[model samples]
Target: MPNKRPITSEDLFKISNVGEAQISPCNGKFVFVKTTIDEDQEYRSHLHFQRFDETSSVQWTFGKVRDHSPCFSPDGKKLAFVSNRSGKSQIWVISTEGGEPQQVTQSKNGASNPVWAPCGTQLLFKTSLKLDQDESVFDQEEKKKEKKKSEPLVVNRLKYKSDGAGFHNETYQQLALINIETNEITELTSGRFSYEPSSWSPDGKSIALSANLTDDADYQIVSDLYLLNVETKELTLLTDHNGVYTNPTWSPDGKTIACFGNEREYLGATINQIYTIDIHTKKKKCITETWDVHITDAAISDMRSGHPNPGPIWSNDGKTLYFTGSENGNTSLYAIDENHEITPIFAEEGHVYGYTFDEDRKFAIIGLSDASNPGDLYKIVLGEKKKTRLTYINEAFLSEVHLSIPEPITAKASDGWEVHGWVMKPHGFEEGKKYPMILEIHGGPHAMYANSFFHELQLLAAQGYVVLYTNPRGSHGYGQKFVNACRGDYGGKDYEDLMAAVDFVLENFDYIDQDRLGVTGGSYGGFMTNWIVGHTNRFKAAVTQRSISNWTSFYGVSDIGYFFTKWEIGACFQEDPEKLWYHSPLRYVKNIETPLLILHGENDYRCPIEQAEQLYIALKHQKKDTMFVRFPESNHELSRSGPPHLRIERLNHIVNWFNEKL
Candidate 1:
């Protein structure tokens, strides 16, 4: 490791991310997606197959196109996956013995999320379709000619636009059945609502799916599980329609269904819990009601893509269920029995983003990542602690770089609340040299900063800056109370917790330069950075990306602003305009003395560009040191999934600003 160079921003192109791993029914083979950046700066992914006993993996699918969501048939003789090779994403099937792949569906909008039936003769998939649109509209060339001119978007619902997906169309996601032998397609359910298929029953006569069938879908914000009779097309509601439920898995006996969801007891801050519902009685019980950890993978990282949240996979015997849980800065696999006895399976200090159990339950193929490694697939034998590394996707690139491994640290807030986080030392650290430190914050006040590989953090550490990132109140992996503690108190105790983290690190680590401290974050973290600069000038420099400066404007502009404001801030702008203005960082911009840099996405609907414009103008009017940078054709996900060149440019801006000020 001594001769290896520090990680560079350009190294982001070299990292390969593994996800959607699935073990074949025979347990001898597994398939996963390996995503990499092409020379054109676009993402390319394909399927990879590997035998359990073999050391090298075979590239199963060939193309520069994206292929993912690999699913095996009941007999494991054929594999089904989704690919955009045909200009639009559609389901494709290939023999396990290797042959030419056959296109199964050719709908106008294309098909995805293919689930093979128990009989293996049919597959269920979802596709976007306009109301009353027929599946026969598959002539792409004809449709292209029929395309109409741009028209003004007439909006009626509150959820009209999204960050990644822009304005809403009339299309709704609908489920359909396709016979692989004859290539015959049949529409199953169609309406204004969208349906997501989960699993097929053992007898292949019924399918379990989730959808919000309520009249007011935009305002209700709750999905319920349902049973769809394959032949009759009769839908039966499973849940009480009071809470959000999804990822329904049928037991082997087909009598009970397991799902992950929770009631809106805490609104958006509610913790996900596992529940079991009897297929006949419609009786539901929360199996993980007493569990303190979140049942979903809330780990945030820029290196991962297309990783799924497959809730509560059932064992072969149906008496036990397996799932991934987030707890204490790690996402690990867990097992639970009918009596609610929990046991840790793969509880290593890393992120277990995806996993799939073989048909016999003999082993599981897990996709895991740590602080130093990007990610890879490993095979873990059931009821054992040992695991065999199956794929070395990023091993070669990892060997060429000296990545910093984060050390876990804890701090006590002013109110005696303990905050948790990690710190990464500079790449080539000398014992006596004082290094500048930068405080990095994560978005989704609800998401956790786990033990996963973050390219941005590594790049910062490589540039001779000690990177400090912490999970203040409102972060996941903690209990429900701790996560909900920051609601309506965004700048109150949460700010104290972050400041305490800096104090704790400075008191413990002597090599950090206190005067050269800098702070930066995005979304919620961006709001925190603005708040930090306005309230205190402890930091010498700050960079806020895709941030929120004014809560009043944010409440009306953001895609989720209307409801999210009341849910997270405890009040709507109509109810208390003064309170919303009080939390607005722009209102106190006059007090900021730190050199501020604002980076925003031009098309970001989550935190609109106006938020950054307001802050930049206010600071400029007051003659404060400030700079504004905007990236066009980008959204809220600019940092993680934006264009390759822009992402690097954004990183370069941050590093340059800190290098100049710190």
Candidate 2:
């Protein structure tokens, strides 16, 4: 046999990935952002250029600073992208061919979502600011940072802190335009509200956007589409429904606008659907309302490749729309025609995370990831489903590594619901040898685990553990009622469904050692791991990462606590503390006999460290075999997007704990 090695964190860093593919308008050449970790342990994403007809790709941008979101000009002469080479992220314009990039905007807070105006000489981008604050106010704030004194944040809004971006007193992302030739920047919309620029109108005089301009904006998840006039500074509202509207792509004739949103029928757990609006008549209709799939991008598997919200990609004729949605545990690209019939475009069995097409939308540049691969770019012919692999960013690593491909497993719940999952046997497995197994759960409680590449799962399998991950009821891509089943019943059927899955795997797979079984998960998965240990203690060892142990404390401290608690559990601490305790894993901590490893991030705002703190204290007080490993300067996304070194350490911690306890 050829010499091969198990995949490691350092090997994963060697696997450079690509995303945000943009096809140049001038020549139909492709330019995308390639992301990788350098020796210094910082993420470096730079633009790279390639011709679809060519066999190789070449680097376009260099250095350690991150560069991404490549958008070609209308004429395709230059490309606009957000880069932080000069300290803060700003829009930079570079030639289609190799050339020095020109800094177009100098926004203090930074600029993103760069879209070239139809006029080509101007562009629209997004920037955030303090409420009722102007550019000069932020300029003064930047000068204050130069003095090197950390200022105290005074927060007043109910939704003052976000998971990734913390402690925003009063900030709103607004749209603006800049004249490239003259370096003159024009603010498009201003107010206490934030504006997300979706698409500029064909005439370049108006732009489509979404914003919630309400006093209870934090409570209200819905936003209305507003058409802003570039010259008059006038705003016209379109589709004022009780749903969040975003990413409005204008039709070629400018008669309609396609947007991705949902009526939020299930509150926080609602699967987003595609909707279209008549710009002239102000009439709106949900196109994918009955489709029973999440219209937004749910294809999340890699921390290296950032998840860009998939769109209602409009064909040049506007008669058809293409988008990425989850179905049958896989997130792939699909299309909807004028007859209201939906069809799969590049709908194979994989995670189609991001895709970009030309003005005509006849062909597309796609980014996909599978069980054995990280991610790569491909070219797809819209009508024929012809795919041409464009770049193999992880070829070298995958070629040299021995990765186990997962086998699909299905089990019917006691309530007759079908649960879809996969099982990955350990590498170098020998026949008739019993191996220790692990039950893996996904986060989001709303997110699905699909036929995509997962680094952690593969790493666990490499360490001689059979990894099993499934998409339970609360996960997206499994239809409306099924995805909504876990809501108001967190530890009830969701718990049963997981146990049934494990029972099914153990019964069918003889090679799995039932006595040496282990369980681990993060986020909602973390909560389930905690729940599993506290409820039954069937697993010999368990590792819970960034988890929620107490719901009462979770309802107040978590970023999404205010709304998520009432939405998921159907009750709150203020309403009924008993209901919270009934589902909280901490409530049954006295029964936990399984050795539990609690992994938490100190800076995790969504599931605060206090959740882990309470669980650890309770377990220790009860003399339970429990250990809490706190990762400082890390957030909830530590597994996927945190510092590279810390991520390796986390993996090492999990492996060490499992190896020691199991």
Model 2 stretches astray by more than 4 angstroms: 132-150, 304-306
For model 1, which pairs clash? none
Look at candidate 1 and tell me the lDDT of residue 457.
96
Q: How far is candidate 2 from the true structure (C-alpha RMSD, Å)?
A: 1.7
Q: How many backbone clashes does candidate 2 have?
A: 0
**Per-residue lDDT over 488-605 for candidate 1, one digit per residue giving the tens place of the 0 to 100 score:** 9989999999999999999999999999999999999999999999999899999999999998999899999988888888888999978888888988988999999999999999
Error of 2 at 418 (Å): 1.0
Model 2 earns a TM-score of 0.97
